[model samples]
Target: MLSSVLRSLQSLTTHNNEHQECATPGSSTARDPRKQVLMSSTTFSGAGPSVGKRLNIDGDIPDPSHQLPALPSNLPPPNATYEHSTPPQIPKYINAYSLFLAGSIEMGAAITWQRHMAQFLHHLPLTICNPRRGHWDPDSRPQPSDANFRTQVEWELEALSNASVICFFFDVNTKSPVTMMELGLWAHSGKVIVCCGEGFWKGGNVKLVCERYGIPCVNDFAELVVEAKRMLKQKGLDAVTDEEIQRDEEWAKGIVARKARKEA
Candidate 1:
């Protein structure tokens, strides 16, 4: 999409340059002011009721009613030939190394994982996709049949499939039944990094599964952070910050609760 947009832009620029060149001394288009009009802000006809009002210059003046088409530019130089750069080392520009955060919510293990992501891997270009990190509700446990739950599951699955790696951290608190189920689902795929701390109910099974699948498994939080960073670096992506992922009120509440639990 970016490449196409760039190509269109290049074509348009070349066209405009030629148009400008044509109007150098004397040409039929020299008298045309439309060619000279560089679109800077929302242009109003100033013909009717809204004539007195100042049109907004922000963000191309959103025209919701009609779709704006790309303006045609003048033709390029007759001798100018197309040039392509040598193939990029990487396929394309990935915003970040997307690592889907999976596993444990007990005692806010997910929050701990998020913090580690910030403390250690924060400098790296990566995005941790953990739905439970901020959306956990203390008042009510949502059922699997709930629309939100189902939708979150769908989104997580999609992120898992698309992510560079699946980082699973098992807290010693809950059984992490859903996490285990997800482990099974993604077991065959080689995109998992399992971390099962001591006393986790399913630690043994998780390890065994990791061994069977030849996936990298760790037992410490620091180890998990290191491994996740290694994986992201190998993908050759730039480090992105938390500013990209906006935490909502619910997520903020979860963070507060996690902090309070730690303080207690």
Candidate 2:
């Protein structure tokens, strides 16, 4: 279904002559719903409304007082660090490496492996570009023309392009066609680390591509994390202060204490 929707969107871009003059020939924004420039805020909370909200098509000026708030700094650093379509309470950090989590979303049906990855690497200075929506309704069937869907695709593309490292995890439980497509897109970019489980339907194909491209491919999730860390360190981008690790430890302890109190 995703592949079909992508095809339809591409077809529209190819045949729609109305906005040809305004769009860049091969730019990512060429397939925009409005076929015009898209302006997004650089801040974590975003400059405009959250995903699923209407985009500002008109050239109306935003009110100065109606500033989008930044995510707070007290929330767990790992929780606050990752990028999602919607804003939630999270801490603020800078000089972070961007790691695009590209694989096996499966419309929220796939296990929340991204969170696990985030937790394991919580102490590292990384901004996780997670594509999974904070709030998604599995029942709703979004069309190719849906604003939310377009926004999400654009967001993921931009994130992947900007990421320092892109990690792909092909879950055995999912067909993961989109993940396969993403792997193909970045395989030659020399910035990918893949974890294709033994039972994945496309494991053989993935292995062949990884071999051809000399991309790091691991059969286990744990190995992927290790490779990611090694890559970051080799690039001299894995600088994590002792303060950050201590902070994360304190946060974990607080979480455990809160859970214990609630249970008692």
Best by TM-score: 2
Local distance difference test values of all predictions, in order: 0.47, 0.56
Model 2 worst lDDT window (10 residues): 37-46
- Candidate 1 clashes: the total is 5
Candidate 2 lDDT (Cα, 0 to 1): 0.56
The TM-scores of all predictions, comma-separated, are: 0.49, 0.57
The true-versus-predicted C-alpha distance at residue 81 of model 1, in Å, is 35
The regions of model 2 sitting more than 4 angstroms off are 1-93, 137-143, 240-264
RMSD of each: 25.2, 14.3
Candidate 2: clashing pairs of residues? none
Model 1 gets an lDDT of 0.47
TM-score of 2: 0.57
Candidate 1 lDDT over residue span 138-232, tens digit each: 22223465554445456666677767778887655444555676677787787788778666644767777788788788665545655665556
